[model samples]
Target: MLKNIFMLFISQGVNYLVPLILVPYLVRTLGAESYGEFNLALSIILYGCLFIDFGFNLYTTGEISKTENKEKIRHLYTVTIASKFLIFFPVALIIIFTVNNVSQFDNIKSVCYILIIQMLSSVISTVWLYQGLEKIRIYSLVNVVVKLLMLPMIFTLVRDTNDINILATIQSVSFLLSALLLITIAKRYDIYLVKINFSDIRSILSSASHIFTGTISVSLYTMSTPIILGLVNTAFEVGQFSATDKIRGAFISIFLILSNVIYPRINKLKVDNEFLAFRFIKKITMIQFFLGLTFATAIYYSAPYIVINYLGSEFQESIDLLRLMSPMVILVPLSVILSNYVLLTWNYKKYYLCVPLITCIFHFSYIIPLSHYYGAIGSGIGILITEFISFSLLLIFSLKSGMLRKIYES
Candidate 1:
């Protein structure tokens, strides 16, 4: 597991680096206003993607973990693909028409369309399938290949064009290519593309309900920032916040890699060695805490220089937000891992309700208002507070449920 985590980290690390390297070039070329417009469109498309995902990624992973039956897995994959395609078309059309009819964000309509296409391709890609099966090598390879291909395209096209449409085109192409690569790999593994099983669709949907809600809530939290910023503040503000966000997001990807690699192992441990599972959780949590704290501090202190140097002087304002939100860099990972742990343990349903509920409340009640008043700093504080609340709640629940006690006894 550790080795896999390490490799996945390297893979994602490369992926993260590409964006960091590209941000400066893109920002300098596109300017803050155009960048803001681009990010807003991306945010809309992202939410669209999340809506279409419908929690199948999590559901499929959990299902795959339970059974290695190739036929069943194939059926689940086929059903998921068919269901996603069915839902995606309408969702994509609604977004394009609604946004176009509303006539808002007129400047970036084409960009939004390209992003929707990217989202559709992303769903078809079944990238999560590789993660579900613990095929980190292929997963990592695909990720690195996409990033490598993107580097040249971004440099050549984005820097020269300064056209948000071109940037969107590059993104769409990248998604299509990555999806194709994953499909090829899946085929090579003899994961046949079976026909859709509508009968199983109902079962899949029922089992996936909570996961869907939780995932949607999470996505809302993620995509809401740009939307809110775009609505309440100037485009420049959105650009600044989005730039800072991209950096923070890159750091958070490390934790994502850790959680993804560990989730299946943790699930297996829950079935095979319950006591060991608790101990494992404790150990990883401690390590995550220190790692989070260390990196948060480093980023907090270094953000000003990093932003100014990498993203240009126009984005220097991002430093304050980065510093304020740096602590969340740690809490976010801890919260995610704990949430996954809770879900895999006995109280799976409860796990879904806890964090997402708190997070949703936190966003609306505190984060949104604070961000409105204080700008990006307020948003950072809101995230910090949200993660802190989530982490505390999960810890309390774990202790009260006797999972922590079991670890101690063992």
Candidate 2:
């Protein structure tokens, strides 16, 4: 598990740093307007990626971890892949129609279109397979190497605002290449692709539908932030929010990497011994909570310095937004542990779905007003509010479910 954590950190470092390094460059070269446009397009593409994923990362990982049969694993992989492909058509159409028709997307329609390749790449990823198998070194290596390779190309090709399309194209191509490489490496694991009928695809999709809903609702509150900010505020505010959000994202990514490392292992342990799994979750949760609090303090205190050093004086507005949203570093990981590791893994899917469903509703209710009145700062506060609501709901549900009580009593 520690080894997996280390490998993920290495890979995720590349994932986070590319953006961390490029954001200032992109912001400086492309100007706030174009950079904001790029972020808006990227946010829209991320929604497509999330839909294409359809919670396969969690659902399939749990399934694969619990089984030792190579054939079963292969069939699971095939069905999940096929389901994504099947879902892709409708999602693609919705994305295309929305991009072409929506007045907000008019400025970046071409960029959005080119970024559809990222959604396709998400469909092709085999990272979940290696993660489930607890042999993620290859996946991590491939991701790190491919993402690193894209840095030079981006630096070389992206020189002006008009090159925004070229930037999107380059990013999509790198993602596609990484996915294909992962698929090829996955075949070597003996989990090669197999032919599956429509029923097989439907079965996996049906099985994972609850998880899909939770993921989508989660995305609604998380991914929709910048989108809402873009629509309600100006491009410069969006750029500021995006920059600060990326900094907060850097903090959030650490906890998520830990969650990813532990998720399958917890599922595997739960299959053998539920109490043991609960204990594992308990220990990890405390550790994550501590780390999260420490991060929150660091971000809260260091926001001004970070913003000035990383994003420059032009983005000074992002300082307060970064500080305001800093607590999300704590809320998000704890919520993940409670929701994914505790509720969903234990088949408390109703509670799992309810947490995000309710929070997303709360999110949409206030996000518009907040963005409208206070712009980036308001959006930041709105996100923090929703995350707190999610964390509160998850904690309440987890405690009331009696599992945590049982762990204590045992």
Candidate 3:
């Protein structure tokens, strides 16, 4: 577990560090508006990648972990390829139409086009295969190398504001290279790319649909905010929201390293000693909460200093927005427990499906209005509210359904 966490930390550090380092540079060079345009295009690429992924991370990875039959593994590999190509055509068309038809995206249409590399690479990279096989070192090595390569490319090429397209292209190609590496290395598994019949494809998609919806719903809420802000407000406001969110999101991601380490562990634990795992989880929950509280307090008090010092004077308005979102740090770890551990451990997989739907409901009902009226600050407030609501909903639903009791009774 320590080895896995350490490896993940190295890879995740590279992933998180590059973007945070670029924020101040990009903000100063591109200014808020253009930087936000880059963010918006990136968001679209995110959802496009999400569509191609279709919950294969959890569903397919879980499937791969469940069995060792090479025939079955080969079949899973073939169907995954088939399913992604099946999903990709329509998604590409949608991307084409969205950039051409969507007025907000008119300026960065080139960025969107270049990001097709990113979208396609997301499907082909197959990090999930390593995670499933528990050969996590390979996954960590690939991500870290690509991220390091991207650092030099970004610094060399993205010297000016007009280079957002170049920056996007560099990032996309890094992903493509990573995918190519994965494809090359994957042959070690002796997996062959065979033709999957339509029935095989249908059964794969059918079994995976709920997981897919949950993934899409998650992308819709978390990744859609910047895009929605673009539709509702100017790109500058998206800059304000995204600037602070980048920091907050990165920190939350770092804290939840436990999630990746513990999740598959729980898969093993539940089989042998679920009661012990439940008790262990109680300790983890407390640790997460206190860590969250500490970060929240620090952000609330010091956002101004951090923003002004790290982000420069141009991002002063983000101080308030950052503070508004501070509490989110507190809820993230708890949410991870509910969503990643509890739901998966207790044979309540369907419960996991419903949480993101509720999050979407809160998005449309509360977040959109708040974003429309109050801009980024409103969006921050809505995030706080929805996060609390999600935490509450998951707890309440578990208790009501006796999943909570099952944990204690174990």
Candidate 4:
């Protein structure tokens, strides 16, 4: 398990690091205003992708966990690919049409088109199949290779200052390369194109319905920030917040790696030793508490230097936003891990419905008002408050239900 976790971490870490190194250049070249528009458009595409992905990734992983039958897994993979593609086409079309209708940002329409293509190709690749199969090593290697290949593109095409379309092109091509690599690698696992079966489709979709709800709710929390910011504030304001967020995202990557590492193990343990699962959750929660505090403090104190020195001085205003939002960086990992554990060990459907429903209410309620009054700063405060409430609720429920106690005892 540790080795698997390490491999996954290396993969995600490399992927995360590449963007961090490139972000400064990207920001400098694109300028904060353009970068803001670019990120806003990208955020919309990301949310669209989330909607396309629905719950298929998690649902597929759960399916693989239940049955080791190769043929069944293959069929499940095929159906998932088909389903996601079917969803992707319409979403991509909607995005394109929607972008065309928006007269405010002419340059952004092209960027959005590229993003839609990237998202479509990615869904077609069905990369999550490897996760479901527990092939962390292969998955990690594929990621590393893709990042390495993208280096030249970052260095040459995306120079200090370039057209936003060029940057968008690079982003799209990188995604295409990763998707192609996954497709080639997938063949080794015997996941090939096959005629879809209606019964299998029904089963996959039925299981995915719960997962879909959970994912959308989760997506609402994670993806709505940029959307909300864009809606309430200027594109330049969105850019500042997005740039700071890109940095904060790197910090959050550590927790994300940890959560991914433990989720499968928790699922496995829940079948026979619920106590072990509970203990694992407790241990992770405590670690997250301290780690969140440490990183939040470090980022808060260092934001000015980091933003001005590294990403350029134009983004100096982003420092305050970074500090205000840094604490949620910590809460996010704990919340994600706890939520996944709850979904896996308890009533997943109910868990999905409750958490996101609460989160959507608080997040929108706080963010909308705060953004209207104070712009980005208010938005940060709103996020911090929403996360605090949501995390507190999850922690309380975990304890009351004996989940945390069982985890600690184990």
Best by TM-score: 2
Candidate 1 C-alpha lDDT tens digits along 79-145? 7787778778878888888668754567778889878768888678785577678776677888788
What lDDT does each candidate get? 0.77, 0.89, 0.82, 0.76
Q: Residue-wise lDDT of candidate 3 within 172-243, one digit each (tens)?
A: 999999988977888877876876689999999988888888768766778888888888888888988888
The global Cα lDDT (0 to 1) of model 2 is: 0.89
Residue-pair clashes per prediction, in order, are 0, 0, 0, 3
Query: Which is the winner by lDDT between candidate 1 and candidate 4?
Result: 1
Clashes of 4: 3
Query: Model 3 — which ten-residue stretch has the worst lDDT?
Result: 256-265
lDDT of 4 by residue, 28-53 (tens): 87787788888888888888888778
- The 10-residue segment of model 2 with minimum total lDDT is 401-410
Better of 3 and 4 by lDDT: 3
For model 2, the stretches where C-alpha displacement exceeds 4 angstroms are: none
lDDT of 2 by residue, 304-365 (tens): 99988888899988889898988899999988888998899889989999988999999999
